[model samples]
Target chain A: MARKQGSHSDITGPRVRDAALRLIARHGYAAVSMRQIASEVGIQAGALYNYTPDKQTLLFDLMRGHMADLLAALEAADLQGDSLSRLEGFTRFHIRFHLPRPDQVFVSYMELRNLSDENFAAVEAMRRTYEDALESILRAGEAEGVFAVPDPRITTMALIAMLTGISNWYRAGGRLESDKIEAIYWDMVRRAVTA
Target chain B: MARKQGSHSDITGPRVRDAALRLIARHGYAAVSMRQIASEVGIQAGALYNYTPDKQTLLFDLMRGHMADLLAALEAADLQGDSLSRLEGFTRFHIRFHLPRPDQVFVSYMELRNLSDENFAAVEAMRRTYEDALESILRAGEAEGVFAVPDPRITTMALIAMLTGISNWYRAGGRLESDKIEAIYWDMVRRAVTA
Candidate 1:
């Protein structure tokens, strides 16, 4: 499964990143230290340097990986047609992508404070790329006369916000299954867009 | 403007809370300290205690007051309507309430970890109350056959998520005016459920 990046380090890197995610999610990123992340990973603070060069790098790696993974997942999903259909696909893909690994989502949202100025701008650019993708779909739908919206850009942000909110409240043992949760969001997304 | 419930201590309490919020919003809550807040307030850290008992109290107080203020604002808007009107009122009210105080919104979202168990529960309860109110409006709309939603609870959450995301990105000098922002959201919310 490993490429130029060794499976050993790739796998171990995520492990450390996961620990940092949970720590930063539970305690704000500003309060976390490299020593604390190292302790969480069952290694000496000095050992963490093997996986990541420094604290900011670790945070950047996690966020960049997360944004990349999300966009890749969206691209991988074979979704097309009207605005409503694309939105349904998005809702389903988003729930599947985010709900399973909530700590990662929480980390990505809250740990932006840890990124250096240059890194933050880069990640934010990626984040906007995803939003623009959604808007592109909505705009196409409007052009095709399949969906009607006063403002496609605002709708895109609204839809994302609505979909991601699922992570804040969804629980593994909850009454609804993940697929069911996806379906629920898809229903709203479709309704929100249908002409 | 201060009420009788306000004392010298009470007068300073809000100043101390505001300083804490600005710092916590700029830096995460865990990284912020009572002494920092005192310094920002231009008062001694010891005087800061006289306003708030401790750091935890200050965090919780800011969050709780935020939630309380949010609910009160919604209640006060009292904008009359059928289900759609009520929801629009909520959308407008939420945007207006959040615009003036981005830092409070930031703290409410980012500082939940700092809240003590009792404090967290209280804020959580109030949040649910606001959510439940919205959910009930959806239910009423469903009953009246004026709105269509697959799940009232999920729809409620989706709307709240979309509304809150505004605070994350909206800027004072942005191309979109605040009223335009509100109208854009209102269009989405209106189309999302109206039958």
Candidate 2:
């Protein structure tokens, strides 16, 4: 059946995705069923099919959408200026972008094994593209003699992992303010990359 | 039922833990069943109870065992010398210990949500002790003016996360040798903390 613009699908589509992300994050993709997701969304089990064909597609969609949003946000951040400035920007941007989305971060990383090989490749390629963004900054800094990157690829992964790990323990009203956290991490990132 | 030492229970215990680790790492604790675990161990479902009281205990055991092993190994590393030396030792030791046990690392981090409140606290305490080992080094380095750490706790977590992230992608016979990988990570760890 052809549905009109912004119909039930449009309204329930986001609800479905949000519910799937929540359930999958809490119980893992392997254990979470589409029926559970539908129940969480206050819909009948069969109604879930209207939004996605199966649990796998729902999972793939959640991950793909997350990456797409991340890439879009990074593009919008428009990190500019010299390599050092851009590197700092990337460091802060990564933390700010990922810190609040703990569920998404958990589900995306934890549920990768559940994705089909083809889906896994797609998500991985998107991830690689994101990593390339940081590696490019490292390369630019290396070329400018501003950063002593012995291994740019490894440096990129290490820095990203370190920054992304904040989500594991950070709380909104924790001991440190977000700005202070960012500043501290920025210092380490700067010193690590530079001489 | 009394069992003799080095009998069937002793032999089957390790197999059960190994199978549980493998299955849980691949499918997650929420999705994996005791029956499947028993099947994987080539034992009857009922006999699986002889190994563990229930799945929660099994998961708690797996996680507790991983952290215990990590702590014991860290103690064995006997990191001595100046703060810098110990820090380098920690950087290398973390990578060496975690890289080869990807499954354990995966379950330890990913299955934290599935752990019971008491189990979670127990594991968290053990993990905290390990982090303390590194934080003490940073604290010492700060006192000696060898390192400039704005936040010792956050720094410890960040460095650990960066070093442990190697397990996510590092493979034996990969492009970089383990020794080379250790050296590269050590450089970042050193610069990231030092002035």
Candidate 3:
């Protein structure tokens, strides 16, 4: 039974998350049911509990996982060099990282009101950490005399919103490719922050 | 009977929209029912039909009403002068206009997926009209050699997204006042497009 449970966990866990993400993105966290999610995953309703305790946990897990993945990807990107270069890296990295995960991005933003106070704080903290990473780069550039950011915090929020907004409208077979879009946004970001 | 119907329609129409907006903003469109909306507005479930044909129409009306108000407000702002000055006016106008209408802003963006195809097209057309206003400003600046926007359409999206994002985080009384925040954002906008 233990071995069987482990095997199911390995394959079914991601499927459950994917299904939940899709449903929540479409219908929202308040509307989706455990039964619908289990059906989406092609599992019995009773068996769905084995994977997640409840709908709230599933939401918390999806949000937490998205932020964790974002932080991990940022670390893996290993942005290096001077603050300007790092800022550019951050710009391109943000666009690339978020474009493919529209559902996650939508759920992360739209479902915040649905998160329990404790869960909301956890997600908010992770978000702050991500924002701080960019804020640090802006501060470093300010110190290095290359950037003229009057308020690093405000600038951080502005830049992130501008970058993340790409996911809202981008489609794969669009007129401008991702690389071109990145270049245009990077140019704007570079100009917006330069001394 | 007609006089009585007109009286109720006069008072209840706005109430129904207001109730639907609040409920949909809080619980999302799929989760919010006509019965819940009626309960919110202190009306009977069947009475909601007097205000809207169905739930879809209510959602469409709320979204359409929000966009209509936005376009009307933009026109009222009557942004005048050179391209650069117009851009500044637009920036300040966007932040001020949206900050007080957070629920409208939230519902306008989040409930797009819930709109029917015909309703979606109607809303999208209004949205494009709004976007065109900004794109025209950018293009004028580009022509006058005051701005270096490579793509006016994309720049419009980026700037609007960055500006609308303020509604997401701004509270009633924060560390920065509205005018100060406007200055900071306007500064960034000015610098970003300056040739």
Could you give the interface RMSD of each candidate, to one decimal? 1.5, 0.6, 0.6
Regions more than 4 Å wrong, model 1: A1-11, A81-84, B1-11
Candidate 3 residue runs with Cα over 4 Å from true position: A1-6, B1-6
In order, candidate lDDTs are 0.83, 0.93, 0.94
lDDT score of residue B85 within candidate 3: 95
Query: Chain B of candidate 1 versus the native chain B: what TM-score?
Result: 0.92
Candidate scoring better on DockQ of 2 and 3: 2
lDDT string, candidate 3, A61-178, tens digits: 9999999999999999999999999999999999999999999999999999999999999999999999999999999999999999999999999999999998878999998899
Q: Candidate 2's residue-wise lDDT over B13-84, tens digit each?
A: 999999999999999998899999999999999999999999999999999998999899999999999999
lDDT of 1 at B49: 70
For model 1, residues A35-150, the per-residue Cα lDDT tens digits are 99999888888889999898788889889999999888888897887666776676777778888888787778777766899999999999999889889888988888878877
Better of 1 and 2 by TM-score: 2
* Candidate No. with top DockQ: 2
Q: Which candidate is the best by lDDT?
A: 3
CA lDDT for candidate 1: 0.83
Between prediction 1 and prediction 2, the one with superior DockQ is: 2
Give model 2's docking category. high
